[model samples]
Target chain A: MEIPNVADKWTSGVNEVTIGATKDKGGSRQKTITVGGSKCIPFMDFEGNPGHKPVIAMDVYDIPPDDWTETLTRPFADVINDPAQWAKKCVEQYGADLICLKLDGIHPDKGNKSAEDAVKTVKSILAAVGVPLIIWGCEHDEKDNEVMPKVSQAARGENCLLGIVSQDNYKTLTATCLADGHSIITMAPVDINIGKQINILVSEMDFPLNRIVMFQSTGALGYGLEYSYSIQERERLAALTGDKMMSMPVICDVGHEAWRSKEAKSNDNDVPQWGPREERGPMWETITATSLLQSGVDIIRMNHPRSVAAVKKCIDRLY
Target chain B: MISIGERINGMFKDVREAIKNKDPKAVQELAIKQTEAGASFLDVNVGTATADPAGAMKWLIEVIQDTVKTPIAIDSQKFDIIKAGLSVIKNEVLINSSKGDPEELDKYMPLAKEYNASLICLTMDKCGIPQDVERRMEIAMKIVEKAVEHEYELSKVYIDPVLFPINVDQKQPALMFDIFNQIKMISDPPPHRNVGLSNFSQGTKEKRLLARIFLTMGISYGLDAAVMDVLDKDLMDAAITAEIIMNQHVYSDSYLTACRK
Candidate 1:
């Protein structure tokens, strides 16, 4: 199809502000990473607005522990006990471009690691990991809201995902993220209407959209993946074809579902012969992540080092 | 008055001679030219009264799709022809029409759902073209309801209170305007309003100019999008004005010019 001349529909990004002005530019860092300033979708320059292509951020966590698989859990075993050390290994050894710290173990109920403990952990990880970091809260909304503010405040200017802002619990999360001066992940279930509504809500609050990434929640492979794929495709098609409001580049969190699903993470006493666990596991992830990428997923939160490697290789292939 | 560009169909001898000669370079050039000229949709009906209408419609649809990306409103009464044309196109589909016939709509409107197609519902029924806007809206509403029932957006369905001659009676133009306004009021975001743009100027010397004036007025209301000629520059110029004046386009909309160029 001939690309329409109406390519430059809108622009939603801006040049990032450096946290501490360096000596040369007023802050202390040897260099500053400026993220966000795209006028178009990832590579759709024909559409006029040349959107900035999203960069990959590898997942890390504070207080790592027990449930690690041999292939994955084994590789990071040395530093799994420390948040700071683990983040360094992820960036130095695993080719991570950015580090995402999932503060899973600090939730009130889950980790019971107080907001103070969470803050200390965030600061330590930031020092240990040179790359820009993204922070994700544990599953419980209340605990996340309680703890994220402190984390955001501690990491002020370092720039991180204000964990998650969901449909039901966005108000507090949004305010915390806004107050602390961090970008946010605008999460939505795999539905276009709901996805768009959340963005509108976030926009209403006047948050800069370029810093906001739309996470179309992942559904496990062979488990309504097609439905999710279709929605993402339609959303992308609508945006690219000229719905200005919906043209924001999309984010897909494949790792969350790849590990959550039985097929991608299970070893077997119950399921059928799905082949060797190692190949089967990463295969499920790589394929799911790749499928979403093809359907216009600009950013992906991935797990499984091997799958991340594979997904990165593929991303390089396309771009 | 929905003005279907009755120019591209192979049923017309010049079009057939141009198309059958494998002259896509020309077929496409002409279609895009018409689309730019002012065709709301370049109607590509490729059939004669005796031919297999479906096959011809599909064939012509393929050619036009290859030539340009503008939505082509299928001009045919036969359901299968409309369906065939609907299937082959990649852009939005604007079915020229189906009047008061429920059975025909049942067999065909679903094709719209299958393809995300739009339509121009001719306001004729078992009785015939209603002489008034109220009745025109009544039939247009039926089409709207059926379209909604089939999961199509009302905005996608253009209700044509099909225009008659202004000379036979100048009342028809007013009736069309009333139909345009009435359909505009059908809902909060009323269904898009349009007409066979040429219908208002039937047999009139100022046929082309009249179509533009009617279209310019249609824009004053909440009318969005239209179907018209792709071969006439004057009409195309009117379209640019309609879009700009209606606030549909912000500043520079030269694609409207490029479509003709």
Candidate 2:
């Protein structure tokens, strides 16, 4: 008897979410990028096409970050203090698909920048780069509620992705994204039910679901990565099985979580067995990203140009 | 699981009375309840309720469409009644169903293709219901071949192994499951597999218990859809739990609510 094909029976697929709107599509960006739409598991091309290639969005901070490792800061030394130039260098020099502009300066204890400062950063980034932008908020809920509306207005009609709406504080950012005609990210703290609930809440505000991407808050390699990995896998499987709320493409914040681990930053002098400081940090980021990719992650937010290259190479071969 | 709600059939007393009196309220209520209960599709059958099956089916379709936008599975053994329901359905439709008999398929295949309706093909033919796994697979293969010959997308065909009453034939459920596993391997993106789930417990004392247990087992064995009573809360919970265990759903504290949403 001839061996029969064992094809996966997927009735639905990851929802394809397009970030940025080009000239004909009601935005000023030079290009737009779409991710998700995989009918099978990630990189399971033999079963079905993953549809869109996984993309890397280089992270850019709104203010100069003092806590970054020297290895991470070396590549952007000239543009570290300037958000626009920082975004430009990421796209033009490093071939980043999208620029993820984090509004960390708006935090109360950080730079304490006003909503005006946030808008200025958005305008400068729009001027510096023509590629799409993922305008993320600082984790401070009250600060995000106060400043994200202005940021959304300044980037109005640019079709930028403005986000990091948690289950408790999704209203302001979600409403602003809807009014400004931009996409937003819905987040959950590694809980699948809450992730789905947030999606329902956002969609109930009349925000188009196809424009929303999910962020099931990331965890570094030793810092609960298994929980994040399994949740991402379950989310993808739910999407493939026709669960509309869990069907949106997923984005994981790898840069912040990976670097936050002591294993990544500690050198032989700080913690004897971890290895060389320079390679340790980026290696942690790369390893963390590669693990999530297998779980069907659609967008990865990353730091360290070297780590980005490593993950991109893996994406190229797998896709 | 794609649940085709089985409450609107004329076999139910309320549905029979509704059809007899031409009272749309009873039919409309079932349509709304089933849709709210998370039924993927509503099955409408005029089962011995009226002498004019075609007319009753058209009226039933109109009432359900007016109440809810849920897609329909037009259940009838008669081609004319199926045609009547198809003509009036405003949303998605599923023709329930065609047999392996070439003549029956010849009459229904074109309607399915023209209406872009999904079809439920039974693993039975002019020779009647197959008693063994091999015979069920043989009939299923023929139905699939004919679907291909008619240029229908295999994705639109739902193959039913025609489950037998477990009370009468205790071995039938296992045989049907074995057939289900192999049938899914017959082609790339094989035809969707479904069953009349309640048939397993027909004429049994503990009907609900048998159905609930067997339905979960069938799902684990690769059944993708079913004609079922969606309002049975315990049965639905069992199905949801089975889906979670199968890794079909993301494990969440409130997965029961998540599945409905």
Candidate 3:
């Protein structure tokens, strides 16, 4: 496992820096976040206790879901109809470590929401959720940059991770995080090479490696999930073996992957032989999240209260 | 080509204990180990040890020089100890460092110049470590600036761009890489560029692997020298790769030679 060493190599990311400072260390929060600061790859407990286990963040969108699966929708009931209540329930009831508010409703064309509307939604979510937040942009690359800065700004001092800075609009999104002094999630589209490339590119911008969490772009079970898993495993192996640029802790956006799968969506009428759809749907997302946790993802972006609980159980067991 | 085995400093408890015991046997064993591990030079530092730092340096230098023919870096912050160390060692000497304290460098650089010994210069000065590339470069130039300013041979001065790990923030690693790269561009006939390997691996879970990997990556940009653990196989392998990449060893054969020898 020893790669031939190069004589003239360089190292980075020394003296682990804590991201979220608490009241004691000079911040508004109750506890500060500690990430990066690793001498080795993820979870080499033999190297030393990894310091902290990966954290879980539940997804509570700025707007409710229209096409989310039946099982996930059932729990929310009328709450799904209200974005603020949905977020509140996620924190108070679900015990989410952090709330990831997706401004999915602000897609400009898809949801047809205004840029101003998106920022207001962000501010409202921040006001509603007690825990630290993760602000997400809709898949629309251009509109995300247009809206992310507004959302990132509205949630300033909260030390949220902006999801995410992509290849196209990275300049703008990264600059916003840089200027605002917040963390960021740099994602690749189910490709290890792309993930490594973005990690290097973002680092070149001087955005702070400790703040940038590499996103391997998740996929649900039975839906090309193995591809994401392999990518994550490969990336982790490279990092542990000593690719400094790719060594940052990985974050998996499991909600997007888990929710969009056919296993989570199809009802019994569509597939009667598959058994009760209720447990099957949540189980599908849960299995996906659990699998990602084992694959060395230091944090997971997940949705569905039941799925979150199941994934947490798996994380506890794995860690 | 001078690989200064960077062990034998007081930071490690065992080495410190060995010093306290005045255990020349322990010192001799470590010397042979580093020499066999391909360290061309042995860096002996009595880091933070106030108790007879000079005496310990003399003891270590004599034992190491006696056990192996490799040169030594008489490394210490205190001047008397360094000179005390230099008086005993017979091989070519590299002044472990002379920067930060202008008074120290003013005294040490000329001694190094007069003795035909090499000097390691810290990029830092009295103002402290600069955060930006331009500032570190300015400091690096200042270190070299002093060498030429003090009439020391440019080649006699080695530049150590003090490297810090991106432990707290994942983003700082590349910033560090950028700083090292900027240091490389500061001059054509560059002062030898070396880094303290352990500084980057500090507080990391995979110290050995990361240390070697970081060194391997540094080769792409041109790190000419390093103060590193000569014992780690992974580190030795990394140095071999870097030697190949930087053409210190041509056609990849030199890797086998550097490592095997």
Best by lDDT: 2
CAPRI-style class, candidate 2: acceptable
Q: Arrange candidates by DockQ, highest first: which order?
A: 2, 3, 1
Tens-place lDDT digits, model 3, residues B57-165: 8887877877889888888867788789878868688998877456667888888876778999886777886566677677777777677778887766777767777
Residue A169 lDDT in model 1? 79
C-alpha lDDT (0 to 100) for residue A270 of candidate 3: 88
TM-score for candidate 3 (chain B): 0.90
- Candidate 3 chain B, run of 10 with poorest lDDT: B249-258
**lDDT for each residue of candidate 2 in B47-74, tens digit (9 for 90 to 100):** 9858989999999999999999999999
For model 3, what TM-score does chain A reach? 0.87
Better of 1 and 2 by lDDT: 2
The DockQ-based CAPRI class assigned to model 1 is: incorrect
DockQ of 1: 0.02
- Count steric clashes of candidate 2: 0
lDDT per residue for candidate 1 within A134-223, as digits (tens), equals 788885887887888888788776556665787777888787777766777777777676676676677667776556766667776887
Q: In model 3, where do residues sit more than 4 Å from their true spots?
A: A1-47, B1-261
Off by over 4 Å in 2: A1-4, A23-26, A261-281, B6-37, B49-52, B55-69, B79-92, B97-248, B251-257
lDDT of 2 at A22: 83
